[model samples]
Target: MTSSDTSVGPSSDLSQNAENFNWLLSRFAGNTAGVRDAIAVSSDGLMIAQCIEGERADVDRLSAIVAGMTSLAGGVAGSYRLGTLNKVIVDMADGYLLISAIGCGSVMGVIASKQANLGQVAYEMTLFANRAGAALTPELIRELKNHIQV
Candidate 1:
């Protein structure tokens, strides 16, 4: 994972928050047994933060996938008169891709191995979202967008 360049932005608070977000995501992936990678993306598909063992291109691809999945799910929910789109789980042969809303117009995407405990990972994702959602304001998102790691 690429560290946020604190010196690149003007607001220390934003920088600190970005760092905190990165740390939180790192912990979520590290502490969870089945989790392989995770990312936090804005409503418009911008990557706010990521915690993955791959290159930047991987992060970008995940961001796009998350955005598309959420959009399609939301559409489905509306079409079927579902109250709200909560989560979308894609169970692949090797692993799973789970996308869930984290509030404040953002969503969290997690990739977990096939052997991972799905229930446990879902619980952890909820915890992480609740803790990080409030801090994901528009201003911080803008700052994060401007200085996201390449």
Candidate 2:
């Protein structure tokens, strides 16, 4: 995916931590031109927040897909005696899909156009995912428990 020229401001949530998440998303989006959408979702495929353009994609479905892919990759790695899953990239005709593990059970996903640079996108995603893991882990666990209870 090519780099995007657009820039988005940070989200105005009362929590400073949330604002940090927004900043990460904004920075990631701004740096990638082919990045049509990006989102932070729990490992169980629940969306925490998203920055999207044009028609709204089904975030839940996307998250679930990424989570499954991540799990599958992990399983494959395990069979080979590999430790953990780092990232998975799905190349399509029109664009590329990237997913990286954030923490214990969370993943960050990005959808970018075919012209986007995979190497740069991967690097930025790794950085963003690391920060997001630190910022989102507690909230995500609480939210996940609530969903489970419900």
Candidate 3:
């Protein structure tokens, strides 16, 4: 899917941590030209936060997709002793799905347009992971999990 013009901010009632995550995700998706949506998921496949320009259902589906993909990739890496799984990129005919680790067994997923510069998107994703990684501690993850409803 391509970019959308609609803009939405994080909800006011979100906890500070969740709000920060939403803000980070929003910045990543909004500032990146070809990004369509983004979501953060826990290792247990729970959606923690999202920055979507369209329907919430779509982002929820994306959360599940990315989590499943990450699990599969991790399984393959472990089976082949290829070391830790870093990222997975699904390049489709119309767009791309990019998933990257965000530390503490959490991940961030991005949906980008067909015209997106993969190199740029990957670089920005790396930056996002680095920025959000340290903050994803166990307690914060639990808090986010409790508050965010997928």
TM-score of 1: 0.87
Model 1 deviation from native, Cα RMSD in Å: 3.8
Cα TM-score per model: 0.87, 0.76, 0.88
In model 1, where is the ten-residue run with the lowest total lDDT?
A: 1-10
Clashes (N, CA, C under 3 Å) per candidate = 0, 7, 0
Q: CA shift at 100, candidate 2, in angstroms?
A: 0.9
Residues 12-104, model 2: lDDT tens digits: 433566566666776787677677778666666666665655423465566667767777887899899988778889999999989888776
Residue pairs with backbone overlap in model 1:
none
Provide the global lDDT of candidate 1 against the true structure.
Answer: 0.81
Model 1 agreement with the true structure over 19-137: per-residue lDDT tens digits: 77767777888789988888888989888877777667787899999999999998898899996767789999999999988877799999999999999999998899888877788
**Model 3 per-residue lDDT tens digits across residues 81-118:** 99876889999999999999988999988889999999
- Which candidate gets the maximum TM-score versus the true structure? 3
Ranking by lDDT: 3, 1, 2
TM-score of 3: 0.88
| CA lDDT of each prediction against the hidden true structure | 0.81, 0.69, 0.82
List ranges where model 2 is wrong by over 4 Å: 1-13, 54-57, 140-150
